[model samples]
Target: MSMGSCDINALKLMKKGSVPGMDMAGTVMKCSTGMWKEGDRVCGMLLGGLSSTIVDKKMLDRYGMQGSCATYCRTQCDMICKVPETMPFEEACCMPCCMMMSFQAFNLKTWPYSNKSHEPILVLGAGTSLGLMTCQLGSMMGYKIMAVCEMTEMADVMSFGAEKTFDCNDPQIVEKIMKATQNALTMAMDCSSTDSSLAIAAKCMGSSGGTICCFPLMMMSAGGKTEELMTMDDDSKMETMMEKTMGINMHNIKIVRKLPTTMFGFDAEMMGCMFKPMPDETKHAHAFLKTFSTWMAEGKMKVLPSQMAQNQGMKNLILCMEECKSGGSKMMCKRLVCAMGETGPSV
Candidate 1:
């Protein structure tokens, strides 16, 4: 209703100290005093949330951002996603980042990760932002996606089209993968960087095919993953035992980097790619926007509204992210909605 209302809405997103809306973003533009239009619809993450930081038309043109997450997103589109009209906003929000990684994974010529199709592909940490979309798109494109979760979440993991799923905590997990694929599934993608998950996926990989997984070279230990993986659990006992038990000197001849991305990708929120019925030369951001808009229009997607929480302002941002992180399935829009406040199941 007023500038104060929107500023408060922005506060609901960050919930921290008052960051001038201009200072809240990656780069800034002078408002020229008169440009601060009353009642402008703006949305942003950290940078946009704090100050008047936003990717104005000029900057959006310069960097080619798709108008997703940023410091200040006043003019690109309504900061609040339109719900009911699209697949709930939360599910739509879920796609932007996850789809980017999926696009990267799909772009690779070495799909199925293995030389053969139907080898029982694995999506490690299959419930996270990127992993879930990867599984969804991977399944859409005819690749079977077998997801992995802790023992507690295996069933939920399988529901996402993991024809086969496993509990990473199982001692006989490798045995499980082998038996499931008739020992043919050599491909795996671990979105989570945890050492135990890495080792589990790696050991399960057949000796002669790609085991696709995403982890930082930094998060990995000295001598790299195979070495780091051996030390996953209680370092002393697991490391010593793994080395002796597995004779773990295997070269990573089959391991492949899922994508070459950095933490900046997360910080910058350049973490997503939109899906298209056709893959073309349209710039990444443009293609994504087109897909997102069209999908919402066609009733192919939906949005569930996020009601504002009382009293809490931008400080709720962390709480919001935590909710998204903790709810797992609920967070990823297994037919749901989310906004500045919360997510609820799809109507």
Candidate 2:
């Protein structure tokens, strides 16, 4: 039941003294019965490869323990959520499920756009795996995108569907974004989940009420920016600042903390979340997988780029995590993959 991969967001929470309970998939390779034979494989997500496979025996021997459970899992990688079989195993494994999570988080039911084409969304951390997928999905949904990341990521983010890319570290970032979007930006997702990133996103959101999404949040924190926004939670306090500078209605800002996995009823209890996926959540997830697979097969949707640590295999997983932390622009907009055994990558 442990995962063979780790989720970077969960790792962040662990660093903050909060225990993360989800962001994992279950594999039974370790059971005494050995449901897995010598050649069998398990499917799961790595912190870097949201889509991946691993050898049952090795996965069991290495990651199947309570202490390491949150960071790794074992799986067969046979489900519809996996990447297209035709693509290289390393590049395809991380995007499928991550795409699904990004799609699910959008909750089309709550989307207020009358015509998606007219709305432009600002995606912070556009170089991260989640941001890359969000850009693709938003494009698919017909929204013009303004992605925020390092200037070096502009070309890559544009290929993924961003209309414009801004350097997040720019002191005049807000001014640049407003000009780029012509102040039409109505929604945003701060995939970076940092104070400065959220502030920039807030500045880009138009004066009218709009939604801004962030990730890896507790149920309660979902409603607004983290304390870094300061007393801005009080609409009156933020009104003067946001209104004069960004033309935003302080009271109109709606912060939606995105908890992608648990929204699908994926181990809420163990993940330490309050809400369970509604009965219809699974139906929707499956629907997404089915539709996503078809789109992939038809060459409509794109799989985010990924890197293979081919020589190292599972032993290199730790390196993948470190890459996420320090890889910077070089690591932007791509996933990292490591093979498990001889082959058997579900394709």
Candidate 3:
């Protein structure tokens, strides 16, 4: 494929004979690897469903189906991955998207969280993938951490970085957070988009305010109840700041969207090849696509607390997608492996 083309545009080019050997998977099947020969294990995010086989969806291999999934470049919002061997393809799949957004919000260099000497900075969903990384990253940078998530996951979450834990479902969660921070807590990264959690983040943020960093994955599921959680029409929960013309604090801690370009950019058709020529970038490529896998192997990053399965492949994918609409916790780090599959993502 010419470096000038990307995603579906490249697919169009392939059909037109301008590009050759372009598999529907969105990668040039016949590109010269230079030193790395064919059949070597390379990890990447496919555009296909992780539940059933991509072949079931169409006729392509599972990985190819994801690469070639209907998510043409225009629809994909610039997320992509090329599989690497040392890294399990499953874990690496969504990291591009998660890391790209989270690192921006939690950039230790720029927006450092408070340490033990100061009030602990809270990550609302520290058990999830972004929360876990925020945990490690915050720990690496010396931030006093508190993770609010499922009761069962608290031990692992605390191991990551949090010093405290609480149930997200508790009605008095804000009061609990207040107690945790000695009523001085202000900064928080609300990784989950459940309206209630957002409300909790705002209420706990002091009147003077603190930063509210939200991942805004409005497309993934938090749990089986994500649809109900996000679709709730509650008025008393998240207040619209009519004064600032924005909901939630209006102007207190700055609210910025964390566009995860780094994660999505790796397999992104636009810039994936741009860094290929840099000799030193070998490590970057390895690090970029494989960070999740590496972390999983090291156990610093853990998977979801349960082994869940989808039975109907794409059909279940559509059925399960409803919860994602409100955006719950699907973005966590645990590799949701297809229980039946032998290679790549489950289905």
Candidate 4:
């Protein structure tokens, strides 16, 4: 198993008698934990994280049933998820990070905004995996979605549960979105992670202010004061960017910053501890897995469109990654699943 820097840091900390993990910088540590045996295959949230167990038949069965493996083991992973059996393997593989996170973004627990069947929600980067999930999940939750993506992708976006779709590249998009939503979006999300996209979200929803969500570390300027951990700085340039780019009065809009581990409901204390799982992690995982699995089985929620790549062997992953990174119209808003030891597209 390979884990991200955050997960690797947690493993290092675990060996030091700290909780299983807490977020930390990766380049600084020398991992000394001898947890791996000679031929053990690992499974965790990321490539090589502390949260792992041996990949067993039960897990493989779940992965096979869901047509993806992202939510195969919620008890040991951070994200919430389950995949549709009809979903292509390539797409199902992305369900945990893309679709599951999107679900959490709309959850009343994580997202403070209220949802009504009549109100519309805005989704930036609707062409992304996360964006596609947001559109599908938001639609299932009973909100009409106004998706922002490339003009070429508008039709595809609409098919994914968007009531309306707008091209982000269109100069008149803000006006178009305003007209579509009738000038008020009660809730919005920014998956694009760009200043211009986020600015548009702010402008379109200004009539009746609402909550906007984005990554936590992103709120800070590239160069700002740093301490042992995250802290709000009044002198920081974040406020300036918010005022100048977004043009919203700070009081009216609430910006919720999310971390990867947060959706599983770990509190500050649990996240900061060492050498133990959060007490509620298993229960949260079980509940989410059950609910989402049922939804997929019932056909209320459909998998985002995806197609398998030509390569199924592990060695071709680098090539697949290159294809994904070198973006194109074809790659937009789609999941590319590269299965192991398979010869052709499964879907």
Best candidate, lDDT: 2
Worst 10 residues of 3 by lDDT: 1-10
> Roughly what TM-score does model 1 have, to 2 decimal places?
0.53
CA deviation > 4 Å runs, candidate 2: 1-6, 12-79, 110-116, 217-249, 266-276, 279-281, 314-332, 344-347
lDDT of 1 at 195: 54
Task: Using TM-score as the measure, name the better of candidate 1 and candidate 4.
Answer: 4
Model 1 agreement with the true structure over 1-347: per-residue lDDT tens digits? 00111122234334233232211111123233443343322222212232222214354334333222222333323112222332433344433434444555454443223323544677887765445656655664567777777666555555555666677667887788777766566667766655556566656666564444543321332243444442243323444544466564334424433322220122111112211222231234334444444555676432222232232324454453344334433333231122332232111
Please give, for residues 1-347, the per-residue lDDT of candidate 4 as tens digits: 11111222234323222222111111101112332232222221221222222123254233321212121211332232333445433433445445444654564542223356557899987876567778877886678889999887777777778988888989999899888888777678876545666677777875668877753322222123211112333222443457754564554666554444443332222123222233343354446555665666577665555665554445664565455445443444565555543322111
Worst 10 residues of 2 by lDDT: 46-55
Q: Residue by residue across 259-338, what tens digits does model 2's lDDT show?
A: 44333333232233233444455466556665665666678866666665433434554564565546544444555554
Ranked by TM-score, the better of candidates 2 and 4 is 2
Candidate 3 lDDT tens digits, 1-347: 00001121223212221211111112222323343333433323332221121113233221233332222211121122344344444344434434434455654432223455645778877777667666666665576777888887787788776777888888888888888787676678877655556667767776677766754233133334333333323322223332232244544655433323232222212111111122223234334434544554565543223223333233343332232222323324342322112342221
TM-scores for all candidates: the values are 0.53, 0.67, 0.53, 0.63
User: Which residue runs does candidate 4 get wrong by more than 4 Å?
Assistant: 1-91, 110-117, 216-240, 244-248, 265-286, 328-332, 341-347
Error of 3 at 146 (Å): 1.2
Error (Å) of candidate 3 at residue 318 is 7.2
